[model samples]
Target chain A: MRPSATAYIYIAPAFALLLFVLFSPVIYGFWFTLFRIEYGAPTDFIGLGNYVRLIEDPTLLPTLSRSGVFTAACVVFTIIIAMALAVWINRLPARTAFIVQMVVIVPWIISAVVATLLFRWVFVNDIGVASYIIQLMGFDAVQPLNNPTGAMVLLVAVSVWKRIGYAVLVLLAGLKSIPDDYDEAARIDGANNWQIFRMITLPLLKTPLLLIAIVLTLSTFNTVETPLVMTGGGPGDATRILAMDVYERAFTNYDLGSATALAIIMFAGNILLVMSYVRLARWQA
Target chain B: MSTITLSSAARARATGRHFVPRLSWLWSGLFGCLVILNIAPLIWGILTSFKGQADLFRFPPAFVSFTPTLENYERVFLSGFGGNLGISLVNALAAVVLALVLGLPAAYAFDRFNFPLRRLLFLAVVASIPLSIGAAALLIPNYVYFASLGLTNTPIVLPMLYAAHQLPMAIWVIKGTIEGIPRELDEAATADGCTTFQILRYVILPLVRPALGAAAILVFVGSWNEFVASSVMVDSPSLRTVQPAIYSFIGFFGREWGPLTASATLAILPILIIFALFGRLMVSGLTKGSVKG
Candidate 1:
């Protein structure tokens, strides 16, 4: 179906604006990655040297692994916990469920930076409640932001806490769409609650679960602020994810060529992930 | 008869049902624990914001402030930091408005008419999300581009960047809302001799006002919280957004917890107020629109 010329004309302004603001910089970044450039110097063509260097960089593999761990941990924890919460809430009275949902959703509204700051204070060694509690429990004091494993745990925990709201909300929506009759029928057939959920509810939730999985994966893969504020990827670079490495290379180290190359690589990986997700979605459909 | 016998047998087997109730209580207790844990951080931040500098770092971390002073708030406003707050407000509001201006009409067109390259255009819009963040990769090229155009570090740059980032989601949301309206209304308006513009104004806009409000609030909150792009593009202190301004609290020597928490509290209040008032509508709009889209 073709639109009238008038409609095309109406959309032209937005199209033009997007082309310049969104597409232009991306195209330029791709082009810039092919050259060796400095802050105030003429670009010299470097062919694939920058790309090769990016592959050979010592920190590259470790950073990528850390990012993988972070993304995987966040995705797994958020889905399981959020789904459980959603299911638990769904089993409650309507008023109680509504209040619980509201409590869960409020954290998502707070700004990422604000959330980071709050958590930063919360994980402070001497002052944080968690630290004090742990000390009280006869464990050695843990400086969450200073230890690599601890920092990763803190980062994943924060991501889960900040993001589980959306996951729970989406899962709740999915749960609501499942008719009550099916559960009742299963119960009448002597299926236990766990069996009923596993056989009926989980299988029926395929689409929404797929959506939650993919979105959570992509978003966590690109997360930057939590690590930046919490640990600065500290304690011998244990917490440094690919995004932070990219930021540090480009801004802190001013290695523009290498940074752009890494960015392109990250972009390629994201596209691959999204394509797989789309294929899976098609297969499911 | 067999089913009834099985049901009675199961009920008899389930006579030791104390475990189920105990498990229910356990789940409820766990949920309550999570809620308290989640809100604890924010509560602590708010408390710290009201404390004096000496009290902020007090060992044992005082739960209550002995004497709360308005000094931090005063400093946030009077000590040149207020300029950054002003910039944040201007940039976020302007970007949201600009996005609406460009997005609403395009969304309307997509919803009302089937056009050539409609799917292609929508895909292009959705593809923009990946390009929005990780500014470090794009900073050099953007710097060069804006330098040539003489727009670097200017206030106009932020809204433009934000509008670009937000346009795709805004358009998708508004389009979903518009499409949910019945097409019969459009036909009725056309039969009444209304042109496309008139039909949109009289028939479609009012119907989708709730969605529009949702989009506006979402955009406002998103842009208000945006950090990376604004930090990279805007260097002038006066033009910095609130996020970067708050970063000032973390100097080489420790941190100024008092001012940081206070300023953060200030920055979050507006969004909190908006969410408190329009939380349900925003949630419904976002969830409904995403699932539908």
Candidate 2:
């Protein structure tokens, strides 16, 4: 058989499974949001009613803005810290760099639910390490988990904590792709450290930085696990991000129409990120 | 291959290395804080896991001073986390095996062939990589579709979905690695009258083994750690996976740290070990796949 014909045969099984699991659902979901689906069946044709309700709903806008806050916070911290760690690793002797990476990695490598549990233990009320240490330092023991703003900040911190390792890895990969020649050439021309970085390194690092930002934004914006596990969207909806809102609308409220509508919106945002990711990715590839 | 770091640290000088500026103590202190920030939760959890119930409420949380015991582990095991752990293992193992079986030939084809619609098909695969990981968007669509098909609440469904989810990544990793192998080897084998299957089995498979290993580890981690769909789709107690089970345990052991910490510790131990052993490979693989963490 010709190679082209055989290629079809080679890809058939995977394509079959992926179509059902990945592709079909997209079609199904888009169709699903157009109706009032009840007990696994569409009972009413409600074209755009679900989406209109979603837009007009009081709770959803706040939920979405909360997600905006969450995603922005996580993206900023993750990129900055990861960039620092990556640059630091680049300068270090090989062994020390590896050790630093290894230390930062453990929290991120574990399950989100597990990581949430672990981080919560650190700041949990009376027995929490943070509280005890604060008491020892002659300060008031602040209960971050119990207050609204505190919970949101704590949630963001936990997210950045777990997310930094992966960002550091990707940014480290980005940093390594830059050569020493740029810095040396700039130095030879009397450029100092800041000038070499601001001009030479930062611009070269732009694509990778953009790629990581998109990836991090996608993960953090639609993340349901950490908030669900830690705060459960509590402290009076303080941490009720868009993803959790979708979950609650569907499972908790049994309102499939609203839930799927929000999901489609989120999915649309995700596709934009994926498109940018694909563009930047192939340039590197 | 799989175990290689994304890039060697010993490689050419990095212009960004002087990022921290002159004060060694400043960066040193920052690095110290980073280590503590990252490592303390894990250490505290492990310590909490070993502490007696009384120690949990103590005014000062004891680090190493608390008398350690395995009662929490015993409690968690006896309360049927063993079963949840087993289901997770089975699902993760199945997902890895199935991803390889379905991904390899296609990855091989993707790299070696000039075929119609190849780019489109490959694009479809790559798009699904991140789509599968970001659970909030995928959960409702997946659940609704599976419910329509009567596929929800089944043991096989999770693994099937997990495999499909991991397939694109597997193909990306394996295909990228295969592309790195010298194409001349395949031509050389073909010149010797070897069939395509023989060349694949004898030449390509062995050469791409590390990628296969890396793909397997990624798939296992993805499958094992999946919670959003697992929690929503499968409601039967016997079929519950570890992450969801741990999530539920919050309700079961509210405000009780011992058993909760113990379960969290137990659940993550295997992944931690795999990561420690294959840290380099996974770093390389995940960034190579460039889709997931």
Candidate 3:
């Protein structure tokens, strides 16, 4: 059948609107990097000047590495926990599994600010549950928020806590896609549960695992909300990772050119992840 | 789903001896800890909201023994949280509506017809899902651009941006669903002399009701729980959404736990209610949107 011209009519408006509101600023971001911007006012174009300036900037490298460490911890922990939890959930009766999923997903469904606030209450300096427990243990009560290492640890823990549910949902779906015969056949062939999981299930889980990895990596790298509320990149900037750095520089320092340069770098990384997601997703299908 | 030749009794027995039965104790223990870890915050927050400041600071905490008061609720409402709640509802509803308005027809078009650049167009929709995830990278640029145009602090901009951000996922989900309506249905409708738009409305729409529900949930949750975009897009106190409103309460009530938790609980309850009602569909919607897409 001949395709209708109305197809374009149906699609064009939505895509055009998306290109304008959602995507145009990204193009404008590229443009902003070439200019010195002061509070939304742009000076003359200085090609690659912003990128060059960042090379000598001391804060840039540490922030990048901090974000790297933070992101790595989160991705690793979230994947491991989510993979294990999904496997366990898959073993349950169908009705029970859904209920477990609902309970598991509440944190993820709550706003990031709320999630951070909730955890912060648990560790509040003088009158917190965790602090009370420490005192009860006969070890002088401690304040995790005020300590640098504790702050970083708390940030990563909170992030991983919120993200595990979504990852499990994705992986469980992947687990469901595998034919029951593969594992059942392995069972009949004298394979133990551990061997069957290692050989049949893990191998088949490759695509979803990679998908979850990419998704978590993107979300973790892009997140400023978690750190913004929990620690506000404070305690001598100890937890000031790259996303927060860009946000602080752009909003707090009002250094548009440098923030734009750093953000462009971040945006470049995002594009790579998006490319991988598209390719991997297509391959899965 | 297994392709085994086992009889019904054998299959039932195989199911009974499902993998990792020996690890049942370990699994249950881990699952219990996780469930507690995930839900304790919510339960504690609710408790903290109602406690008097004295009870809030009590040693060893009061789970159910504390005299719960409505003072915090009074404070939250008296301090104009109602406005923020209304704004959050407005923004989320507008986003869901706009995303659906654009997404449904485009999805119908894709499933039924082949057009120029169809594959590329579809890929663009898929790519948008990831773009929304990495949107923080674009925040500064978006803020600057919006500011340059004097569009910052405007009401329409936030919902429109939210809608556009959700558009791709909406289209991806609806496309996956609308594809399942066998073309014979459309052909049958056509044989009865139905027009294109008429068939889409009368025949296709009802068949894909779950898709519509799923897309609505995705867009609603995305917009409702959104803090970063809602914060950056508008600075006016009058335009604050519930998430940012709860966040701003930090500045207002620093170290004052009562109103903070009250506002927090208020922000959480509506979404939780929706989730409680439609959770299974939401979960299926998620996998259907992603795995199928």
Candidate 4:
């Protein structure tokens, strides 16, 4: 049925507010990117100059590589660990399983900044318990956020730890969606547990796994807070990812034109990735 | 042939019995390791937060402080730090409310109606992701725009920007939840002579409450931890959120570790409490909204 005029009335306030607050700003971003506008000046049409400048920039390649590496490593770690956790929890009796699951999920809900702060404390040179433990285990020192490689490793580690809970939950949901008859049938056929899981459980879990992978990849690519708070992209830009680079160029250097260019590229890339995932979903359908 | 089959089947059963318990033990061991790794940082932070600065620097570290004082807590809570916490909570809560108000009905419209330019409009809304790349990317134009409107440095600007940034995701999520409610309910309401607003208010609103709560919590947590935009948009010391406050505590040389940790703990408490009470719903809410949307 067609919506009544009153339906239009109900939707009006929301549309008006979104137009002002959300839509206008986004439209203005594209407009600003095309113009050679400083923070406080009349806009001049620059055409594709900003985009050209972005292509010619030296730092973009390394930043992209760093972001890619971060995403790949973090997604791999998150998925594997979350799957293991979900399998373990699935084996438990109901109530205990739920309590343990709740405990695990706590980290996911914690604020990013807070997690960074907590991890920063844990990685501090002398007084940190983690550092102390590592030292006791015969390491000289663990500079988790101080060295570039160390920082990247820690960033991925933190990302995985914070996110594993959600991954576990998602995987559990996927596991529950699978029919027990498949497992029973495999058992009756004298198939081993590994063979049953490999053939049935893994295939059934592909969709959820793909969803988790896509979300994690996007999030890792877009992440700013962990590196921002934990390392400040420190030990001399070793930990600097694309998003931080974009922020530094725009805010620190006040290069609106180039910053917008980078923003557009990043935006395009994310959209493409998401669209690819949608295509995969459609293919499965 | 029968003897061979029976012997192989018995060997297979024996092997399966041995493998199952061993695999179970291995999985449990891995999960236990993860639990330790996950809790390690927070536990360390809590311990360090209680230590004196001198103790913080002591070699081998002091896991158990000989002397623990309320000094750091006092500095954080009584020494003007609480004001920053208060501002963060107020800004985050206000922004969440604004986003929900602006997002819910739009979500309903998208879920229920096929208006002109529907896909295009929805795509426009979903494209807000990149706008959040950094405060800097949008800050220049926003600064100029807000200045022209006489809203720069005002409390309104941060929430407005946050609400705008968060609206798309919120709308998409609520729309997904709204779609999950079958259309027949609305038809029934209409057949009973209820107006659209009456139907939404009486029927849709109550049904979507769980999704609404989930969106509210997510938005609130996002705004509370928001740093880049708030830092750039609001320059006044009193207007800064908790994240920037933590940043400021660490100057060029070194950080005030004790009070910083205390403040960090304080900042995390509200979200933790919310999660503690609504943990399961929150997870399902995130996955449900995110997976579908």
Candidate 5:
């Protein structure tokens, strides 16, 4: 067989799966949104009714806004914390750096289910560790997951906590890839520590920073388990981000039409984020 | 004394290197505290797993000095979470094998051969990195489609869905590794009258073994941790993964703190051990994809 024929042969299985599984389902999902699905079947051709319903749906705009806030908070906090941790890890003695990383990365590797379970226990009212600590400090023992705004805050915190390790490791890898000579030369030129960090370090970090930002943004945006398990989208849907809302629409409401519509919107948001990242990444490169 | 100190500085020619040692300790300490904060929840959870129900309800929550018990573990195992854990393992393992089988060749073809729309196909797969099979949107369609096919609640669909989700990462990581190998090796093999299959099997596959292993571990972990799809697609109690099983313990059951913590611990122990053993490979695998891409 021709090499190209052979190559096509090699690619066939994966392409077939991706086509049938990923691409087709997404497209079929979009198709499903154009119709009214009832009892797991399309009953009527709605022809954009679902999309229009999405716009007018009272719950959706708030949910999107809530998800936006959560994603923004998570992306910002995770990047900042991870950046600081990476800088600190970069400065540590090599051996201690390894050990610190091993400890820190425990959260990232552990499943979100377990992480949420742990967080739920830690922040549970009255009998929980964090709540008890707060009570000891003479503050009201607030169950973070039980209040509206507090639920969003807790969700973002847990999301950040779960993912910060991966971001830190990636950022550290970026930092390490930058030669020490850049800082050395800057120092020899009479630059102070903060100045060197500002002028030399920050610019060089744009790629990894963008990489992590994009990655974190997507991960945070798509997060279902944190809100689902931790808050159960509780406190009146205050923490029900888009992913959770999608799940609720599908399974809870059995409204596959709305579910598909919301899913498409979410995927579009993801695509927009990814497209911008690609543009920025290209410009940086 | 001021003159001596100034002259000593001039003689020593300190270029901020001396200042580094003192501040290094401070940074290390700060990082130590941060690391503690990072893993604190897991530590607390593990402790709670060993605590009796009453001990878990302590006012300030005892960090130590309480008599630990295995009753929680006993309850968890007796409740048949072991079965749920088994499903999680099987699902994850099946997903890993399927991803490798389908993805490895795709990665190789993309790396080695010029084909029509290869870049487009490759870019499509790259984009798939952020796309999850467990997304509620896709899952809705999948639920309808699979239920129509009578595949819902079956054992294979979760792994199949998981493999689809993992295929993108598998392709990207393996492709990155394959690109690193010298093309000259393939050319030399061809010159020696080796077929393409032989060259791939004997030479390229072995060379990319580490990357493949890393990808497999990542895929497995991702599959193992999956919740949304598993919850939606599978209805039978026997089909429940550990995550959904753990989730089931909340709310209506009034939170059996001991059994809950114990079961959560049991569910995560394998992943924790894997992370401990292969953490470096996992980190390198992730970095390898990000940096190269």
Candidate 6:
């Protein structure tokens, strides 16, 4: 075989699987959205009926906004915490920093479901750890998952907890790659810590920050396990982000048409968010 | 006086060899507290799993002085969660194998072949990372499609779906690592009259083993952790993976904190061990894979 033909032969299996398993299913899902399926049958060609439901449905707008709020909060807080952690880690004595870095990685590597379940136990009203801490501090025991705002906060915290390690690691790698001369030179020139960070560090850290922002935004947006396992979209749909919304619609309600339409909208929304971030980053650059 | 200042600055630079500019004890303590907070929940779960059921609800939640019991383990095993554990192991292993088998070659092709539409195809692979939400999105459609073919409730379905979900990352990681290998090696192999397939099988494969290890570890952990699709795809009790099985503990053993947590602990322990064993490679691969593009 010619080299190109040989290359094709080598690549055929993966491409074939990707095509049939991923691409085909996605295209099929998009097509499935245009028709109403009743009782396991495609009962009518409801071209855009389900899509129309996205606009008409009462819960749709609230759910989308909730997802937006959740994603935005999760991304922002995760970046702050992780970046702080990274900056600190960067400062530690070498051996201690390595250990701390490894210690922080446990959460990221553990299963999300397990992490979610663990947090559920940790915040379970009075018996939970957070509440226990609250009681220790002379406060009333609060069920963090009992209200919409509280539940949303808990979900964001859990997602951030799961993801902070990755962001820290990424940012740490970026932080390490910076030559020490920049900071030392600034220090010698009478720049204080904050001034050094603002003038020298932050500007150079933009690439990794953008990468972290994009990845964290996408991961948080696609989050279903945290909400599903922790809140179950509870406190009156306060935490019913789009991923969970899609899962509940298809599985709980068995509304395939509505589910697929919602899924497509979500898919589109995610694409738009990612593209906007890329554009925004580029524009700022 | 200028020479004195310069010498002092040189001495300061030498002493500051490991300097991470302006990190103070207060900042270190704050970071330490955050790290403790980060791992505290998991540690609490582990501690809770070892406690007797009565200790879990004790006022203030017992932090110490409770007899750890084997009863939770007994209860979880009696409830047949062991089989679920076995299924998770098999599913994760199968997913890794499938991901690597499908992903390595694609990575190789992208690295070696100057094919048409290569950038577009690479973008498609990268784009698929976000699109794997299709795993959740196509749950209903996949259900209908598989249900019609009698594939639902089969052990194979979840693994296959997970492999598909993981394949993109596998390809990306492998591609990034393979790209780092010099093209001169490939040219040298061709001069030796090795065919393209021979070169891949002999030369490229050996060079990217660390990446392969990294990709496999990732896919294994990811498949093991997957919950959404596993929950939606399989309805049979015997075929469920550990995540959904853990969810069942909530429903079946409601308020039974001991066995429930014990089960969750068991679910996490294996992955934790795998991660510990491959910590460095996993860290490097994860960072490399995500930051490359």
Pairs with backbone N, CA or C atoms under 3 Å apart (clashes), candidate 3: none
Q: Which stretches of candidate 6 lie over 4 Å from their true place?
A: A1-3, A273-285, B1-23, B133-135, B148-150
Q: TM-score of candidate 6's chain B against its reference? A: 0.89
Task: Answer with 3 or 4, whichever has the higher lDDT.
Answer: 3
| Model 5 C-alpha lDDT versus the unseen true structure | 0.81
| Candidate with the greatest lDDT versus the true structure | 3
Against the true two-chain complex, what DockQ does each candidate achieve?
0.46, 0.58, 0.60, 0.41, 0.52, 0.45
Q: Write model 6 residue lDDT over A1-285, tens digit each, in one string.
A: 123756666678887877866766556777777778887556678888888977899998888889889989998999999888898889778998887988888888887888988878887646877887888899987777788888888898889999999899988888998899999999899886789888988898898898778778777887778898888899888889888888888878888778877776666666764554444332100
Comparing 1 with 5 on DockQ, the higher-scoring candidate is 5
Q: Rank the candidates by lDDT, best first.
A: 3, 2, 5, 6, 1, 4
Which ranges of candidate 3 are over 4 A from the true structure? A283-285, B1-23
Error of 1 at A66 (Å): 1.0
List TM-scores for all candidates, in order.
0.92, 0.93, 0.94, 0.88, 0.93, 0.92
Error of 4 at B86 (Å): 1.5
lDDT per residue as tens, model 1, A1-285: 125766776577778878877667666667777777677333798888888999998889988999999999999999999988999989989998887887787677777777888878776646766677777799888666667788789889888988888888888988998999999999899898899989999998888788778767777787666777777888789889987777677778978778777877776677665554444432200
Alpha-carbon DockQ of candidate 6: 0.45
How many clashes show up in model 1?
Answer: 0
Candidate 5 or 2, higher lDDT: 2
**lDDT digits (tens) for residues B239-274 of candidate 1:** 989876776555421477777778878888888788
Inter-residue clash pairs, candidate 5: none
Docking class of 2: medium
lDDT of 5 by residue, A36-100 (tens): 87787888898999989888998888888888899899999999988888888887789988888
Report the error of model 5 at residue B51, Å: 1.7
> Which docking category, incorrect, acceptable, medium or high, applies to candidate 5?
medium
Expressed as tens digits, the lDDT of each residue in B73-177 for candidate 3 is 999998899999999999999999999999998888877878777888888878888888888888888887787888889899889888988888888888887
Give lDDT tens digits, candidate 2, residues B123-173.
777777766656569779888989989999998999998899899889989
